[model samples]
Target: MEARTKNVLEPLAFLFQLITGILLFVFVIYHLYVTHLAEHDALSYEKVVERLANPSFKVAYFVFLAVVSFHAFNGLRAIILDTDFGARNKRAVDVLCFALFVIATAYGSLLLISF
Candidate 1:
């Protein structure tokens, strides 16, 4: 039963990783262009605040943060699963990865909200 469940979830997890990877690529390129290639004045403190004041921008930025955090930790989980380390303690690996993901995403959210 456990093996059957693992088989079912493995494909879903792979698909999730693929989708998140694509999203991260798009989000990162957009972020880089906005933060780095845009006019210097575009990133002024006031401008940043004004941008975040828009609800759409705020929601999109939060999604970006969540996607990036999930992708990073999911990748870490995949790497761990590929090694002997995870074979002995798969549940621990999953718990650690999830905890880190939550912590990272929460921290980023706080920063965005408080800014």
Candidate 2:
């Protein structure tokens, strides 16, 4: 509630958003290049599976998913905090954001690992 407390958190939020935004940009380009440009042939399920079969590719995919989930959830939190109601419910909103981020990251990790 105190302005000093808010100031301490402000820099953290800004720093995280900045890092995630840069990561998301890099991931998007990687996705585009790998999913499209790298594969000239019509994408087949077999080809996809073959690509995902590599250990390195699997790791990269998981990183992409994790980064994407974090970036998206953080963006949502920022949007929510822009509203008057959200500004008042900071604790609840922060919890909700973390919960969603964890759940989504878990689901994505499972899928990537399974593949």
Candidate 3:
């Protein structure tokens, strides 16, 4: 890739990772807080399920899952590239990573929709 393209893509990828990470963190915290309600006898497990079944919450969860999966898969690819593995088999590794990302994303989407 050209230097200009690299410059643009790098920042975009970084931004994506940052945003996804923050969202995932927020989701985790929210999940914990909601679960904690049970401890106080203020919320039941069924209530949690009902809340998740809400259309808005379901959409948010699906989006969160997508973003997190993308961020994580790309991060793994970057890590591999940073090491000798990518140097030895750059083309093969890149192809493999692309395939894995597609497969994972599709499967995750299916699960999110079906569930």
Candidate 4:
């Protein structure tokens, strides 16, 4: 059962990484387009702020933040595991990464709600 669970979670984690990476890439492209609008005087700073103020956008931003944070931390964890430090303390590093992910997600959600 433990082995089965690990197998399931491993793929799920990889899927999350893949999805979040794609999402971040898309966001970067969209952000660049928005920035381009500034060059044409079509994108005002106030307009950006107002768009973010929309409740739906706020929620989507929060979700994006959470996913990106988790993906980044997981990537770091993977890198650490590829090094000597992780060889000696894999479990500890994993726990730290998980804690960071939770804290980031909670803080992002709080900020979204407050905004």
Candidate 5:
């Protein structure tokens, strides 16, 4: 018996979902610890500004922003795709979802970097 290959788009979307999920998980943990459980003094507004001022921190924040939005929108798309309504409109759905991701990344990066 021969194995079947998936439609290229489905596999790509699945891969993106998996990768972003893992990224979101790791970033979320780090963010929670930093925001909620780290040193008390670091919780100050000025300290937060100082942290965000770091280039590494800015990069991490942008990554977190992009991954979170993608993860959320893609996961939602996956859920909806299981329904009859979604099945009939895959192309439109994919395009809309991609647009959403782009828009989110643009807005989120602005907010993340302008710190």
Candidate 6:
């Protein structure tokens, strides 16, 4: 008996999706707590400016953004892979998902920076 896969990267991709999903969950919890559950006015303009002014905050924001974008598209890719169309067009699915991830991450980063 032998294990078979359409692509060698399938296992790696699954691992990535799993890890990113966990990270996204943690990040979303933090975001929600800060924005909605925190005692202070976390959503106030001044507070937002202060937080964004910190270099570490910016890096954390970028990581959160990237993780979120990757998780979204990777999960989408997984769903697509489950379908006949994606299974038959693995390369096409990969390219499309990667392109979408890059575009979304770049746009989100730009918006964060400009904020």
Candidate 4 C-alpha error for residue 15, in Å: 3.0
Which pairs in model 2 have colliding backbones?
none
1-115 in candidate 1: lDDT tens per residue?
8699879877887898899999989988988787778868778889889888888877889999999888889889989988998978888998999999999999999888886
| Candidate models: Cα lDDT each | 0.88, 0.85, 0.73, 0.80, 0.85, 0.87
* Residue 34 accuracy (lDDT) in model 4: 60
Give, for candidate 3, the lowest lDDT window spanning 10 residues. 34-43
TM-score, per-candidate, Cα-based? 0.89, 0.89, 0.70, 0.73, 0.85, 0.86
TM for candidate 3 is 0.70
Clashing pairs in 4: none
Which regions in candidate 6 have their CA more than 4 angstroms from the true location?
Answer: 1-7
Q: Give the per-residue lDDT of model 5 (tens digit) for 1-115.
A: 1123327667887999899989988998998899878877778899899999999999988888889889888888888889898888876777888899899999988886788
Better of 3 and 5 by TM-score: 5
Alpha-carbon runs more than 4 Å astray in model 1: none
Residues 1-115 of candidate 3: C-alpha lDDT, one tens digit per residue: 6568757866886797798888889987866776674456426667656766678867777776777677777788778867897767756765787788778878877765664
| Candidate 1 RMSD to the real structure | 1.5
For each candidate, C-alpha RMSD in Å? 1.5, 1.7, 3.2, 3.0, 3.5, 2.8
RMSD of 2: 1.7
Answer with 3 or 5, whichever has the higher lDDT.
5
Stretches of candidate 3 above 4 Å error? 38-49, 88-95
Candidate 2, 36-87: lDDT as tens digits: 8987862788888888889998898888888888888888988998899889
Estimate, for each residue in 1-115, the C-alpha lDDT of model 4 and write its tens digit.
8568757877887898899999999877766776585457536767767767788878767777887898999898889877999858877988999999999988888877765
Q: Candidate 1 clashing pairs?
A: none
